[model samples]
Target: MFMSKNEPVSSPEALLQQIDTDRPLPPLEQWNPDFCGDIPMRITRDGRWFYQGGEIRRPAMVKMFSRILWKEGDRYFLKTPVEKVGIEVEDVPFQVISVERTGASPECLSFTTSTGEQVVAGKVHPIRVELDPLTGEPSPYLLIRYGMEGRLQRNVFYQLAEWAESHRINGRQVWTVSSEGVQFNLGEG
Candidate 1:
């Protein structure tokens, strides 16, 4: 059965592919931390990058320049320009996080970067659909700003987890913590 709008999509792989592949990814150093709200960051003793915004940083690995896409209601939202050591060749892959109700416009969360950073072009909003209470008919379609901030946070966690897994960095046990108190332990490969 198809998941509801409030539910997250099953596979992130398709979401990853939906990214604007033609558009060049931004350099890691050029990623603006402010792109996804205020993500607390710290330099690891080993020189690895760490996101200190939420408690998840204590256990899970965070990365830079990745993309995550999520679906909330009917709309779609994307978080990009993740900050990590080595994720992309030219530019970092942004996360396509959540798709909220349609017709809603959400603000873009901002963060600081190591050096030069690129500004995101255009605004991404969620899709919305209204159903009849009695007939269960879809109508009154309109997008609404849903959990934009929350989605961005989740995107960051997922990107880092994916990166860790790709390099065989014991990512399976990674835990994704969000400011909204959402936590998940990523499976190991």
Candidate 2:
């Protein structure tokens, strides 16, 4: 099904239809495409899509483009069966806009990305925080899918931090959140 960089082997709708309920995301891992070099696409730090020098305002189109987004090491790409085109990502590809808590005792935390994808924070989809060395500002993220991470928006990170439990680990006060029996450290409190 190899084709030119501008030609798609399957329509976006057809590719979407192939996604099973059990597997919400397309099977991009199975694709082994040739590098078609860089595209004019870029995903901003705030999660807005841009093409060339103009903003891509259509929500549907942005979501569809996100479906084909792939990352190898640190670089981002839009990949299909035939070609993989590089794209710039100012930060991570996805932004976690909202989070929901479920269950009673051992509550489960589920995150919703800006693109409408929901991922539960568990052993599989772990949350992590990185601190800026100079300013000590925390940047939190949730693993979305296929080794991609969704950066937690400021409000979302704050909400999760409020739900975190304080613990003493190795003589340091740590703030942590538990989901599906796995504890993720928010940071040192």
Candidate 3:
């Protein structure tokens, strides 16, 4: 069952502390909870959470769900210690809402997500652009964690473009961005 807003998810720090991410994830990979059936829950391509034909409309509730979301194989689920259930996700599970410059040894960019995750684009969280074959529209994604990705909102992608640098890699012109002292090639464009 989906956790309600009344649950103890008062802050993102509180949930991050529970995960203690400095350590490996809690045995979510090993334990297979009984499938509790699907719920009318979905994450839209624009990062809106919908339940029972209505928008969730609560940031805290969305952030809480982001913490518990788990992906196994090609399916996505919200898992707790005791149970798990499937949910639909259009495109990716998160949307990058903003980006800002951050101070680092050689400067870096910080991308903030709708769920309040700050992913620094570089080595671990590399950035990539995928063009839709039908529309030729470019979609940018940043690897968030554990096989999940955050798609950048249109405006945020423009913000990132301002900071991008063009470089020649392997005799081809490529665009790149640096964060966490690492450079991620955004592909030749």
Candidate 4:
């Protein structure tokens, strides 16, 4: 079930790490081919809930059920399950502000998830697109951005192609919408 604004979460890092360790990493081949390809999408724990950052006093976790893939040369799209039985899914609209693809991957920046949650209050924000440096000029790399409540301070970006390569998650090929924008990559740490 989805978490209530009154619930409590222990540690974000520990929670994420635990979920990562406990869940069976899906094979890359299993990932939807349409969702696959070289692109980035936001990643969240399958069952955990998310809360607002600073203002949220209670425990909130966003159980990410599916993802939206924003690829270049196409329109924006979402890849969510048919339905979430017990969870209450909120819809937060978002716009693609800036996107960048670099270092064999891509990242995007937009309204912070928490910010959207606070303003929009219980809605899924849109995924923003950034450039991909590895693929020559900057281009949409199929990335989605989401606000992480509870413990995360800043927004997080997820890349589908990178996620597939790392987790080996696989799926069938699907078509998506695209928009025009510049590309970029995250610099070295």
Candidate 5:
């Protein structure tokens, strides 16, 4: 059943702790909560959260909500043990806000999302680039967790390009990077 506006929601602070990124996430996959209708919350392409036409300026609140975020098919929702609330997503739910190269023996690219989720690019968390057919513009993404992906910011993409090495794969020239002994194609050359 869809919950109406008059149906009161619990306080955000009561839902979870704030600013503790290391906290473990809820087992949303195992939850079979009932739909509580859509909320005014929307996650922007650049990683901004908005509610009721106003931006949710608190990073902690955003992070807290992100912990319970669940994606099913093409829709996204904030799921709890008891209920689920639909939300809007402009692009992806997250943005790869920053990235850094780490490890000396087998150097890896470590990515940090706006919500403070850190993911290392490798076989488990692969990096993929998609090109728009009409514009031919590149959009790079990193698989975050549980089928969630974070779009790489323009600057992060440029950084990867700078470190990318040229290689020939399947008879085509391409830019690649190696992490955990796995070669990932950055783009066609």
Candidate 6:
């Protein structure tokens, strides 16, 4: 689907439906557009979208831009079928704000991102945690299609922690969570 940059964007539902979950995401991993410098855009650690030093304030606009969000290396960008622009990210590019345990025996866990994309915890959307070298704090993330990940909010991480159980991995102990018959290590306990 060729989308004009200025054409009024559609709802997030329409955007998501266009990208089939069973199929690969819109080839962001393959795109290598030239950086268009900073665009006065930033996604705060907590998931708020800001533009030109002001909060976007409109969820519709946030949802619109999110559909085109692409991460190349350490930086983030908004890409259309043609144009690409670089932007700043104070922390993670996206944030997982909510989680819902569903499916048979509640083995499937679904996470809702700040962009409104819902990803199920499984092979395609595995959950991971990284410890900060400086603070030694745990930072949890959920895969959000392609190579993109949504950093889980503090409370959301706490929610997943409630579902986690300690297990022995190798000769050490680890915090793990299970979904869809698969177990994911949250971190070392």
Identify the candidate with maximal TM-score: 5
Model 1 scores a C-alpha lDDT of 0.29
Clashes of each: 50, 0, 0, 58, 0, 0
Estimate every model's Cα lDDT from 0 to 1: 0.29, 0.85, 0.78, 0.27, 0.85, 0.75
Which portions of model 2 miss their true places by more than 4 Å?
A: 1-23
Candidate 6's C-alpha runs over 4 A off are 1-37
lDDT: worst 10-residue window of model 3: 3-12
For each of the candidates, the C-alpha root-mean-square deviation to the true structure, in angstroms, is: 21.9, 3.4, 5.6, 17.0, 2.6, 5.5
What stretches of model 5 exceed 4 Å from their correct place?
A: 1-6, 16-21
Worst 10 residues of 1 by lDDT: 83-92
lDDT of 6 by residue, 1-189 (tens): 222345535443575555544443466656665554556688888788887788878676677667678877887788755557777888777788899889887488888987678788888788888889999999898888657788999998888888889888787888888887788888787
- Per-model TM-score versus the true fold: 0.17, 0.87, 0.80, 0.19, 0.90, 0.77
Cα-lDDT of candidate 3: 0.78
Provide the lDDT at 29 for model 2: 96
**Which has the better TM-score: candidate 3, or candidate 5?**
5
Residues 88-156, candidate 1: write the lDDT tens digits.
111111222332212224333232122112222123332222345797643211111223222122343
Candidate ranking under TM-score, highest first, comes to 5, 2, 3, 6, 4, 1
Q: How many clashes show up in model 6?
A: 0
Q: How does candidate 5 fare on TM-score?
A: 0.90
> Distance from true position, residue 189, model 5, in Å?
1.8
Looking at model 2, the pairs that clash are: none
The sequence of per-residue lDDT tens digits that candidate 4 reaches over residues 20-58 is 322432232233333321112232322123333222222
lDDT of 5 by residue, 82-162 (tens): 788999999889899888988997898899998888889999999999999999899999988778889999999998899
